[model samples]
Target chain A: MKVRVTVMLKDGVLDPQGKAIGHALQTLGFDGVHDVRVGKVIELDLHGAGEEETHKKAEDMARNLLANLVIEDYSIEVVS
Target chain B: MKVRVTVMLKDGVLDPQGKAIGHALQTLGFDGVHDVRVGKVIELDLHGAGEEETHKKAEDMARNLLANLVIEDYSIEVVS
Candidate 1:
């Protein structure tokens, strides 16, 4: 199975990198561009794991290393 | 409308950060964890734009700001 995990900054978090990119876009003449928030996606390929086991593993991966839960939120999707 | 842009390291790209994260996961006792690749997602909220316009804007954003096309691949979705 394949798993996709998306980790994003929580609302109200200050995203300096996103802000910098937004500024760059405006400089490049992209009109009507507003706020830009950047997050992360982690794609995983698992072997010999059922959906239940894979979900648990993916959650553990997110909490342990993939995302900083204090400032980021994560969601996982399993593709069989 | 809102837009989601996902950017990922291309196949065969060396992702040192992802490797480090994978190593950390294994050290933390995550069994069966294999390769891990980290990517990015950018969310945008736009004002006064139709779906077609938003799609065009999103493509421009991906090309000019959100992604490094040389080493990364990106996809965009427009949410109305």
Candidate 2:
């Protein structure tokens, strides 16, 4: 089975990297760009797990290791 | 308008960060985890653009500055 996790910074958190990217885009002449927030995605392939089990395990992974809970939020999807 | 870009490393590319994350997850006792790959998402809020224009600009942003075309693939979505 395949599990996909989307992790994103919580609102109100300072995202310097995102700010830098936005600035860079503007400098590159992409003036249409405004607010930019950057997040991450983690894809995992697991063997010997059903959909329910895979999602539970992936959720645990996200909570315990994949994301900083106080600053980031994560959602898991069973992709396959 | 809101646009989102998902950037991912191409298959066969070495992802040291992903490897480290997987190793860490294993260390944390999530033994079900395997084959972890990490990517990124960028959300952009733009004003004064229609869906077509927003998507086009976001695609250009991804192709030129948001992602490395040689090693990564990017997809743009009009979120709002």
Candidate 3:
């Protein structure tokens, strides 16, 4: 199975990288952008796992490794 | 309008970050994972733009600033 985990900063967190991107976009003349938030997408390919088990494992990985729970949130989806 | 751009390494490119994560996952006993790829997800909130214009602007931004076309590929999606 293939699972994709999206890890993003929590709503209240400050994202300097995103701010920088927004600023750059404005400077480059694409000025309609008002907000930018950058996040991570982790795609994993697993073998010997059923759909249910794969989802569980991916969630476990997100909780333990992919995201910093204090300031980040994650969502997982099975792609294949 | 809201646009999301996902930027990922080209299929044959080396991804050391992903490999290290995979190794750590195995070491931590989540051994079903065989491959991993890490990518970026950028969400932008734009004002004063129609959906079609937002999509075009996002594609332009991805090509010009968000992605390195030589080694990465980017996909844009309009969320709202």
Candidate 4:
């Protein structure tokens, strides 16, 4: 199974990298852009018995290794 | 409109960050994981006339600023 984990800064947390990207975009004349948030996407290829087990393991991985519980939020999806 | 841009390293490119994450996961006892790849997801809030224009603008942003053409590829999506 393949799982995708998306880790993003939680709402209300400051994101300097996102701000920098937004500023650069505006400087480059992307006037329509109002806000920007940057995040990470981790794609995992797992060899597991079933989709349920894979999804559970992916979630555990996200909680334990992929995301910081304090400032980051993570979402996991089992991909085909 | 809101747009999402996912930028990832080219297939043949080496990703040390990804390798480190994979190794860390394995060390932490995620035995099911076989392979891993890391990428970026950028979310943008755009004020535009229509979906098509917003999508086009996002593509332009991805090409011009978000992705390194030589080693990275980007995909744009008009997110609700």
Candidate 5:
């Protein structure tokens, strides 16, 4: 099975990287862009695990290590 | 309009970050995890642009700045 975890900055959080990216886009002539929020994705391939178990494990990973709960949120999906 | 860009490392590319994450998971007792691939996601909010234009601009960003063509693949989706 394969699971994908997406971790993103929470609402109202200050994202310097995202601000920098937005500014860079404007500098590069992409003036239509309003805001940019940068996040991360993690893909996990597991063997001998059912969909439920895989999702559980992935969610655990996200909550424990992949995300900062105070500022970031994450979602998990089973892809295969 | 809102656009989401997902950037991932291409297969066969070495990902030290992924390896480190996998190792950390095992050390933390999530031993069922096999392989992990780390990627990135960028969310862009655009004002006064149609869906087609937003996607086009996002694709341009991915190609020129957000992703490295040599080792990464990116997909752009218009979410709103």
Candidate 6:
């Protein structure tokens, strides 16, 4: 099975990197670019796991390794 | 308009951070977790832009600020 995970900064958190990019975009003539929030996408390949088991495993992967729980939240989508 | 951009490491590139997470997931008892590749997602808010303009602007943003062209590639989706 394959899984895709997206991890994002929680709302209300300051994203310095995103902010910098927003500013840079304006400088580069991309008018009207207001705010940018940056997050992460993780793609995984798994073996020997069913759908339910894979979902659980993907969640565990997020909670334990892929995300910083204090500042980030993650969602998983299974493909194939 | 709103745009979502996802940036990912090019295939065959070494993703050290993702590899570390994959190892950690195994340690945390996530069976069948094999390979992991990490990427970035960016959400943007724009004003005074139409869909075609927004898509072009978003691409400029990606090329100028959001992605490292040497190691990463980005795609954009417009919503709202």
TM-score for each of the candidates: 0.93, 0.94, 0.97, 0.96, 0.96, 0.91
Clashing pairs in 2: none
Residues A1-80, model 5: lDDT tens digits: 99999999999999899998899888888887888999999999987889999998888889999999999999998999
Q: Interface RMSD for candidate number 2?
A: 1.2
Q: What tens-digit string does per-residue lDDT give for candidate 5 at B1-80?
A: 99999999999999999999999999998876789999999999999889998899899988988999999999999998
What range of 10 consecutive residues in model 1 chain A has the weakest lDDT sum? A39-48
- Which regions of candidate 6 fall more than 4 Å away from where they truly are? none
lDDT of 1 by residue, A1-80 (tens): 78899999999999998888788888998878778888988888766799998998899888988889999999999977
Candidate 5 TM-score, C-alpha based = 0.96
Shift of residue B35 alpha carbon in model 6, Å: 0.9
Clashing pairs in 5: none
lDDT of each: 0.87, 0.90, 0.95, 0.90, 0.92, 0.88
Q: Candidate 4 chain B: worst 10 consecutive residues by lDDT?
A: B47-56
Per-residue accuracy of model 2 over B4-80 as CA lDDT, tens digit each: 89999999999998899989988888786679899999999988999998988888888889999999998888999
Model 4 lDDT tens row, B25-54: 999988867889999999999986489988
Clashing pairs in 6: none
Cα displacement (Å) at residue B52, model 3: 1.8
lDDT of 5 at B62: 89
How many clashes show up per model? 0, 0, 0, 0, 0, 0
Task: Estimate, for each residue in A1-80, the C-alpha lDDT of model 6 and write its tens digit.
Answer: 99998999999999998898788878877777778898989999999989888888888778877889999989999987
Report the lDDT of model 2 for residue B22. Answer: 87
Candidate 3 off by > 4 Å: none
Residue A38 lDDT (model 2): 94
| DockQ of every predicted complex | 0.77, 0.82, 0.92, 0.91, 0.88, 0.84
Query: Residue B32 CA error for candidate 2 (Å)?
Result: 2.9
Candidate 3 chain A TM is: 0.97
Write model 4 residue lDDT over A1-80, tens digit each, in one string: 88889999999999899999999999998897788999999989999548898889988999999999899999988896
Q: Which docking category, incorrect, acceptable, medium or high, applies to candidate 5?
A: high
Mind listing the fnat for each candidate? 0.79, 0.90, 0.93, 0.96, 0.93, 1.00
